[model samples]
Target: MDGRQDEVAGAMARLAEGDRDGAASVLRAALARAPDDPEILHGMACVARASGRADLAIGLAGRAIAILPAAHFHITLGCALHEQGHLEPARAALHVATLREPRDVRGHAALAAVLGAMGRGAEAEASLRAALALRPADAALLHGLAARLSGRGAHGEAEDLYRRVRDLCPEEGAAWANHGAVLFALNRHEEALAVLERADGLVPDVAETLNNLGLVRMALGHLPQAGVALARAARLAPEDARIAVNRATILAELGEDGVAERLLRGVLADPVAAGGAEGARAAFNLGTVLLARGDLAAGWRFFEARTRLLPEGRWPDIAPWDGVAPPRGRLLLHAEQGVGDALQFLRYLPYCLERARVVLELPPELQRLVGTTPDPDGLIASRCTVLRPGGSVPGDVVARCALLSLPHLLGMAEPPPFAPYLLPALSAGAGGGERRVGVCWAGNPAYRFDRRRSIPPEELAPLGEVAGVRFVSLQHGVAAGDPPFAMEAAASGDWLETARAIAGLDLVVTVDTAIAHLAGAMGRPVWLLNRFGGDWRWSAAFDRAERPCWGDAASRWYPSLDLFRQAGPDMPACAWRGPVAAVCAALSRWRDGRLAGD
Candidate 1:
């Protein structure tokens, strides 16, 4: 090799090894020898990028490309421009680099990155797939494609690709960590935990790996272990607002609300964080903590952060309806979250019906059930039209608002009137003479925090020991397991049928699921099994006493619902033993009371 070429190669090696000063020293000498050599200029560009001088790197790379028009020089230029946030220019440079050398993986990879940064995800995936076709077993290419698929919610396909990456590059800690994340998204929590732990072992000090480890541990209800992992991650990446937000969430779960609040506020105060996803998360979490503790005014304001967190496409196209003056024509009330959220907010429909001709959009499962929602004078039936998804919105619907936004818009300091807003759809002789108690141990698994709220069927065994209470399975979607207790009423059917069954029951004992909200709305006695740091609807202080103290407006929103919170922050690692036991004791008292009356 020529001496200048050899010097350029050595400088590239130094840059790869993270010795930017050594790389610059070699590149300086090589540049002096051959002032116009594109190879030496490219080497200097690499050194500049490693030293965080994206502007200098872009200049050097441009000079190299100008001198030789090499594909590699263009790739360097594209990456430097991307680092400088010039996505359009970066995309142009990378596209040129790819056309100059279609066989080069570096050019394809760089181009894909620019495309992804430009939010052209489909085109970026196509680029990665094209590269993968050329080099099918390339670990970096496989990992990149897998990440894109995972981001787009093609988790099963992503998991398969991530598996291939693990096989091709067993020592790649990043591949392992990402594989774990896809598994977690697929709701394979145990496998995800194992994979993340393996990743942590492989890259012990990496903040990302540790953060993933913390999340998996938290999912498994191992709060103390999760805390340790997150603490290490926070120490490693103190400036990372995402990591700080995650740690604060964990602390909130552990009942360290003061510490969590401080950390979240600190994150919110950082301007860079305030402008991104992390800032929105911090705001939402702060709102949740405040609402859980009954700080209503600030809580509702910050709780609106959830609106900011929604994807741009999810927003309604029409202008928002301010709750002040009644809409001149029609008001559209839409469901933005889950069925439970819809159920919780449907109470406000009557108020809107009183003002304007209302259109309520909801999931199809809710259509039949919503018919039974409280309407003393049948105003809802007369004035409101229910729209299922894909059902037409009338062109004259002048203004729209999210259902959850009603409380804030109405300027509610406390919940309006939470008396039974839904009527039971049953006849007089529906339930048998015995005291039938419907029980649900799980919610929809697709919920992001389902692991925290759901209980294993076995955890309900203690209730079996209670005498005279007939426990019926109210759980749907999940296969009903053989519980230690006998079910007096069988489980099955659509949400309306479930509502019929719940109406016949003497009481409902349920985890924090839609059923709990349904029964509460029906004014059935509801024993809500709440996890540590439960949903904002159940005030955090609910766990303090033998029976829930309904001092907070959040809790007061469900008058018929009684909470059985996990005993302490330490619980749930014990797998709902405390709450289940409390439910058993409460059920025994209820049964005895009923028998005495009979």
Candidate 2:
């Protein structure tokens, strides 16, 4: 090679070896000797990009591409443009690179990232596949592909890719974190925790790994441990809005609303972090906490931030239609979150129907249940639409909204006062002179915060001791066990059957689970048992006191239920005892009143 070409190659070698400063110095000296050389200009651009000077990088790359329109020059220019948020230009540059050198994995990968950022999942996936085809064993490419797959809800494929990445790059903290995230998505909490812990150990100072560790711990119901991990992560990466948001979520789970609110507000105040989806998340969560505390006006305002909070690709971009008049076209109400969330938020269908023709896209499991909802027009079931596939809906719908956001739109100032609104399939037989009470002691094990929210059957023994109240098991799955109460497992059928059984009972009592939501929806008197830090749905506006007695708590979208919270982390058992006894006393009083009338 010529002397100049040899000098360029040496500089590139230094860049590859992590000597970014040395690479920049050498490239600068070479650029002085050959100022307009494409290779030298591209090399200098790369070093500038690595140093976080996107403007300088873009200038250097543009000059290089002008000097010689080569694939590497285009690729370097694209990288700089992508960093500057010029996605379209970046994509165009990457396309040019790929056309010039179709086998270039970096060019394909850059295109994939830009496409993914633009919310074009299918195109991104295709680009990612093309990149992987070129460099099949590249760990970074595999990680990117796995993330895109996970985003598309292709957990099986994503998990396999994550496993391969973990196996191949055992020392890569990011690969371990990604693997743990997939495991967590699949509801493998124990395994997820172990993987996340390993990742944390591998990179002890990494804030993201520590934040993930906190998330897994929260899922496993280890509130204190999760709090500790989150706190450490927040301290280490104070500027990382995601870590702050995560820490706030854990605090909310622990029922420390004051502290959680403060941290979340801090995140919101930082414009740099707040401008992105993470900022929107801080806003959305802040609204949830505010609403839980019964601050109606502020809660709704923050809740509206969901439109901006969601990361691209999770949901479609649909304009928010004001409920003033019927929409000019059909509106799609897509389900977000879980079955219980769909059921709880279905109350908003009436409000939406009042405003426009509505097409309700719900989980198939809840199709029959949602069908029972009394909607005069425009409620359609989403059948065979690939939530697991990167499928897109027909673009004809005028507007779209997430199902969970319905409650906020309906202006749920307090729990809705409607009871027995959701009727179950079971029949209510005459109580044999005893107050029949239904109970669910657990929640979905897959919930990230289930450990802190769900109570074990054994932990419910104290409630079983309530006199004159016949407790029935409303819980399902392996989590249910006969615990010395008048209990029957929900019959096999649909949720309608479960709803019917709950309907027949005089009252339903449950921990933070779907059954509690079912009972409340059915308008059956429900006394909901809550963890001290309870979900954002239960706390009051002032004093952080637990809200029990339907009307006593703030009015909301679902209002037939009362909340009783365990006092603190160390005294969860003791905290619940008083509330259980109070419920027993209330039932006794009702019984006595009936007898007196007779």
Candidate 3:
């Protein structure tokens, strides 16, 4: 090869070795000889990208493509644009690369990636299939299709493809990692661990692979193992913001929020680290830390970053109410979170700005519960198996907002009045005054923290022993079976009957579940058995300090409800202990009033 070509090859070698400075130096010399050489310009662009100079890389790649119109040059430009979050332009550039070299496998893969990011799932899958047909067993193409399908929520199909990729190409580290990720997404943690271990064994501990393993381990409640994996990942990739965020989460779970807060803050301060997907996540973690410390203003500000983290089309087309009082017309308020969250925030409806005319869109399971309440202007119950725009709503809706956003929008410095928001009853009373008490021991199992929040049925045996207290079951779901206490079966999936049962009860005691919120909203006497160091909303530090509402046993959020926290320092979050003895002791002090304390 001639001297100019030799210089280009040497520059490429330096780029491959991650010596971007040396690569650029050599590329400059080559470009000096052949000022318009596409190969030299492309080599410089790759070097720029290696050093995190995406704009410079795009500029050089554009110059290279202008000279030679090569697929490799456009591919480099597309990749740089993708990293910078310019998906549409990236897709256009990648499309040009595919046209320039129809059989360019990497170009097709890059195009597929950009298309997926743009939410064009079908086109992305087609691109992958086209590339896969050329090299049917290629690990990259197979893994691409597998990841695309997984992103589409087809975990079963993704798992099968991921299994094939791993088996067919045992030496490829990505195949193993992809298989493990899909398994974890499917809630098959044991299989996920096995697959991740296989990947770690093959690659011997890449930062991303170890990070995924740590996440799966954390989900399985193996805190020590998760800590070990996450610590190692942080060491390997100290600059990776996601590793720091994951480590912070584990630390918070272990009740070490002080250190976790510092780690998350450092990630947010680093511009490069706080950009892309990890940026919004760091903001979220920081928001939780601030909220836990009772810093509402800053906490809510950072918490709003959640919208940026969410995927496209997660909400409807209506403009979200920007914390403003409407002139007229009904505001379409919808529940965007879990049942418990929806129930908990309903207290804010009466306090809405200017006594706003509000309509609600709730899941069908919650219809019967809301039916007892006469507050909302109107209610629309619908099934949301697949999300889309324009849910059933009344006409003349001026704006929309998720129910969870109300507290922040209202600038609520303190909890609203704890008076009963839901009406008295929808069904006839149980007709007896034999000290009737209702109990719930479990929450929706699909909740991420259900294991920590739910008390095992066997642990509730103490409640059954309380003399003169009729223990009725308010428990729902498949977990509803024989409570240690006697429970009359209400119609399955019937929430109104459960409400009626609660209305007739002298007191209701429950763990952190939707029923807890329901009983509290009804202004009935209730005892909330909380886990140690639980969700921030339950923490005494969550509310303003001077109002004197939060105590060890009292909550500002609900005046009729008393809280009984599990013993701390030794009570693990994943334990099966119940606070029934606390309830029994309080029942002994009861004066037979509607409120527990009275």
Q: TM per model?
A: 0.81, 0.64, 0.69
Q: Ten-residue segment with the worst summed lDDT in candidate 3?
A: 379-388
Segments in model 1 whose C-alpha atoms lie over 4 Å from true places:
1-107, 110-119, 311-315, 352-357, 377-383, 427-429, 465-467, 481-491, 540-555, 571-573, 594-598
Error of 2 at 120 (Å): 7.7
lDDT by residue (1-598, candidate 2, tens digit) is: 2887888888889989989988888888887888888889888888888889989989999998898999988998998899999999999999999999999988999999999888889999999999999888888888889988898899889999999999999998888988988888887888999999998888786787888888888777677888999999999998888999999998987778889899999988898888888889999999989887778778877987876755335444776555444436667777767677777777666666665666567666665665555433433232212132234555655777777666566665654445444654556453566677778877776565676677656566666666767777777766775453546555555677677777668877777788877777777777777776666666655222444343234224355676665656644445456556555555566545542123
The collision pairs in model 1 are: none
- In lDDT terms, which candidate is top? 1
Query: For model 1, what is the alpha-carbon lDDT of residue 245?
Result: 90
The C-alpha lDDT values of all candidates are 0.82, 0.75, 0.76
Write model 3 residue lDDT over 109-195, tens digit each, in one string: 889989988889999999998888778788768888988889789989889989999899888777888899888888787799899
**Candidate 1, lDDT over the whole model:** 0.82
Q: Go through the candidates in order and give the clash count of each.
A: 0, 24, 0
When 1 and 3 are scored with TM-score, the better candidate is: 1
Ranking by lDDT: 1, 3, 2
List all candidate RMSDs to the true structure: 5.0, 8.3, 8.5
Q: Model 1, range 276-357, lDDT digits (tens) per residue?
A: 9999999999998887777877787788889889842543587787776563667878888888899988877777676678
